[model samples]
Target: MTNTPQPVPASQPIPDSTAAMKSAVKWGVMGLIALAVVGALLAGLFAGKEGVYGALIGAAVGGGFILFTALGVLLTAKLPALTAGAVLLGTWLLKMILAMVVLFVLSDMDFYNKTALVLVIIMSLVVVLGAETYGVLGTKTPYVDPTPSSNVDDDE
Candidate 1:
C-alpha cells in the first residue's frame, strides 16, 4: 500500500538498451554465418581453387564487419530497440535486394551460376526465417531488475 517507489532492475524495460544491442549482435552474427556459408559455396563452385581461400577470408571479414556494426549500434544508450531492429532489418533487406540484382544481372548475361544463385536464394530464406525466429525468441528473454522495490514489484 506504500506509495514508495522501489529501485528497478535495468533489464525489464521494453526499450532495454543492453538487450537491444545484444539482440542486434546476435541477429547480425546469425546473418553473417548464413552469408559466410553462401560465400564459401560460391567460391568453391565458381571461384576455382584459389576462391576457397578468398571465400574464407571474405567470410571472416564480412562477419567481423556485421558483428562490429551491430555491436556499435546496440552499445549506445541513445538508440532504442526499434531503432536497432530497424537498422539490422534494413541492412538485411538491402543485402537481399543487392543479391537479387546480382542474380538477375548475371542471369541476363547467360552466365548464370546455378550454384551461386541457389546458395544466395537459400541464404536469403534462412536469413529471413532465422530473423523471424530470433525476433520471437529475443523478445521472450527475461529481463531482471536489480531493484526489487521498484514499481515493477507492484505489478508482480
Candidate 2:
C-alpha cells in the first residue's frame, strides 16, 4: 500500500482564450472598417459630388457604430449579468447619439442626404441589437454543482 503524495507543478500558464477571441473580433471589425473606408472613397470618386460626400459621412458614422459593437461585446464580457445589460443598453444609446450627430453633420452639408442618414441610423440600431441581444440574454446559464454535498440524508 502506497501513501506517497505527488508534487504540484509551479507557474501555471496564463490562459489566452478570452484575449485571443477578443483580438479576433477586433481584427474582424477592423477589416470591415477598412472595407467601409474603401467603399466611401470609391463612392466619392465615381459617384456625383453629393453621393460621394454622403457615403463618406455614412462610412464615418457607421464605422463608429460598428466599433462600438465590438467595444460593447468586450466590455459586457467583463461585467456581471445585470451590469452587462446596463452597458449594452448604454452602448446602444451611444450609437444612437452618434447616429444623430452624423445626421446633423450630413444635413448641414446637403439637403437630399437626409434619407441616407436615416438609413444609417436604422442600420446601426439593427446591427447593435442583433449583435448584443444574445449577449445580454446569455448571462443566466443554469448552475450545476459537481461536488456532492454532505447534507443529503437517506433516512427520511
Candidate 3:
C-alpha cells in the first residue's frame, strides 16, 4: 500500500496573559494560605494566643496585598503595552500606600503580639512571592509552534 499523509489541525490561539495571571493568583493565594497556617502554628508555639492573633492579622494583610496586585495585573494585561505599564505602576503605588495605612492602623491595637505580626507578614509575603515567581517561570507557554512535522517527502 502507498504511504498516506495525515492532515495537521490548526493550532488554537494561546490564552492571553490574563489567563496566566489568574492562574498565578490562584497559586499565590494557595501558597499564602499554607504559609499563613505554618506561621500561625509557629506563633502559637512561641507566644500563645496573642501570637495566633498576630499571625492571622499578618496573613490577612499579606493576602490582601496579593489579591490587590493580582487584580491589577489581570486588569492591566488587556490594555496597550504602554498604558498597561502606567496602570501597573499606579496600582503598585496604591498598594503600597494602602498597605502602609493598614499597618499603621494595626500598630495601635494593644492586644496582639506586634512582633509576631510583623514577622509573619514578612514571611508570608516572601513565600507568596516566591511561589508566584516559580509558578510563572515554570509555566510551559509556547512561544512558537509547539508541534512540528518531520516528513520531508510531505513538504514537496
Ordered list by TM-score, greatest first: 3, 2, 1
Q: What are the C-alpha RMSDs, in order, of all predicted structures?
A: 7.6, 7.8, 5.7
Candidate 2: segments with Cα more than 4 A from true spot: 1-17, 48-51, 111-156
Give lDDT tens digits, candidate 1, residues 1-156.
656545546685545535645665667567767676767666777756445445554454334534544555555446777886777777667666764565465454433334444544455445544653475466644456434543456553
Model 3, span 15-109: residue lDDT tens: 55566677777788888889779888999999998998999898888777876787787888778989988988898898899889988987788
Candidate 2 has an lDDT of: 0.56
Q: Once model 2 is optimally superposed onto the true structure by TM-score, how far is the C-alpha of residue 104 displaced, in angstroms?
A: 3.5
Which candidate's lDDT is highest?
Answer: 3
In model 3, the runs with Cα more than 4 Å from the true position are 1-13, 145-156
Which 10 residues in a row give candidate 3 its minimum summed lDDT? 1-10
The global C-alpha lDDT for each of the candidates, from Candidate 1 onward, is: 0.55, 0.56, 0.79
Clashing pairs in 3: none
Give the winner by TM-score. 3
